[model samples]
Target: MSSVRKIVSTLVFAALTITSFQPALALSRVKDLVEVEGIRENMLVGYGLVTGLNGTGDSLKNAPFTQQTIQTMLERMGVNTRGQTMQTKNTAAVMVTAKLPAFASTGNNIDVSVSAMGDAKSLQGGTLLVTTLFGADGQIYALAQGPVAIGGFSAQGDAGSVTRGVPTAGRIPNGAIVEREIGFNLAAERSLKLSLRNPDLTTAARIASAVNTYVGSPVAVASDPATVRLAIPADYKGGVVGMLTDIEQVKVATDQSAKVVVNEATGVIVMGSDVRISTVAIAQGNLTIKVTETPEVSQPGPLSNGTTQTMPRTKIDIDEGKGKRMIVMKEGVSLQNLVDGLNALGVGPRDIISILQAIKAAGALQAEIQVIG
Candidate 1:
């Protein structure tokens, strides 16, 4: 009873201290936490062919799609390949992808990524022909064309081959030209919505307060933890650009819940600033078993016609840490105290992971435990 009461008293004091000090260190920018609803990028994808490979291209016999695409491309350019057999390893079928940024206008150039879609060894020295990039709506938005800049290469020897990085993927800088515009009239809309990247009621409320205070009006309202509604001001009516510029620059304080993330594969443990632990006792030790084998040759008796024999010898050993002792962790331990306590146990990172898991299972850890990898 005495130990429990002492722990409870310590936790109460620590909670109060933590709450008072948080206001000084939780500042963040509005742009980092919230994003406008309609301001986003779109993914564009297209099928194209990469030519001028030194025999590392797709084999026409294995990938018929490559031959078909080449034939179609040539036919569109007034080339007659109808009755001719197209058997070549200098062309490869590839998928080109790019991102169309919001508010992008026609004639704007963007980079495109090219990846082989067929059995191609390398796309090192290849040129991507003219291809139309389409969005999810099946509308052509951009046209991509140029020589590919492969970041890696592949070489073969008589014995083996060596590859550095990804030889089947390449990039073309400023190779895609926007042909159509996807317009979003934010100025024409009556109200604007801000979406929180990580939804939290405290963060949403703080954002709303900051915007309202800066605009000197109660035009901003927190609809929920993930959404904020802002009414257009009279001065900025039909001119949402200025209002959004100011809103995105406003500074606000954000809040985070106590969490502990553990990566089992790498034996990494991360703890939040407000993580706490109730009074608990922990004792850890490792048991290791080792085995050894030895073979010996036996000789026949001096005068007897006995055959030579062999004898096998085996040895087993076990070692378990006998000096391990339980250590009691007091409640409401600070970050420094927690580190010191864990270090005092003289255990490695893997052992610490097991200890943390055991603590969480015993309901002594006062934070959400997330195990990944």
Candidate 2:
């Protein structure tokens, strides 16, 4: 009996240790928390046409842009159209869009998304012609041209129409080639600036400390909660690439403010670890009402010559659920305790959402509550 008790005690201690070992704060790599300034993707857009759509393309009379673009394309191909009126239903006008990543070089291929810009039935099995994709500065940066790979299809018959996925938008892998590159040199800067996606003073301080410790010198400075400045060290003066690589690999502990997010449309509720609530009591119940109607026909007695008659009867019932039972939550309750208490109440997700809103309104919830549809 003594040996058995000792073994059980040891197992219980080990289990407790394992369960309590979770880090209250999460560790995140520098690369995910911060981004190098001036290093981002640029949006490129253009208008073009998609051809080879089997009889599902836009009507020429309805989508004039399709006819006009075809005419212009044909004219560019050295076709004379002095008095020509052509009609074709195998083409669609589309908007070509691509993201030009930083440091993209000439002759490099990139993917492009093509969306129907006019009233088109489907863009499946279509080929996009050469189109000039221009940046926001109005400078031509790349050219997009390739066969569109549509992920959806549509079919129609005398009965009705059926569509699977979106057939009007498609993607062309490696369809655009970069012609010009953005002028920015990473190694030329004396100091590199890292911008945090979510600004927090404590996280910035931790990052700065981690960098300084790793480099054995004070090369990183937390200029603000959102920005960190790093001066290039003499040994790394050859190139800032190595320093950036090291800085991005450092891991720092992260903490966020307590917040409770609720989505009413899907009835989703998310609570952070630090979420708490003051002592509060909640009582909720539902009332249901139902009405039933019945119609009956009455026949005249035999040989009485009485006319037939119809009678209507209605029944109504009202039911109030089991009397509301109040549940009291103590102050600074743990998430497990709160969840168990709510579960014992047997309320649904939507009911929980409404209860949380009421609690927040009553100033009992000790965290910010965000409600989204």
Candidate 2 lDDT over 273-333, as tens digits, reads 8789999998878788999999899999999989999999899998786765789999998
Worst 10 residues of 2 by lDDT: 80-89
Could you tell me every candidate's TM-score relative to the true structure? 0.84, 0.86
Model 2, runs deviating above 4 Å: 1-24, 290-319
* CA lDDT, candidate 2, residue 4: 100
Residue-level lDDT of model 1, residues 252-365, one tens digit each, is 978878888889999988888888899998887768789999989999989999999989999999879777777889999976677778887778877887888888899998
Leading candidate by TM-score: 2
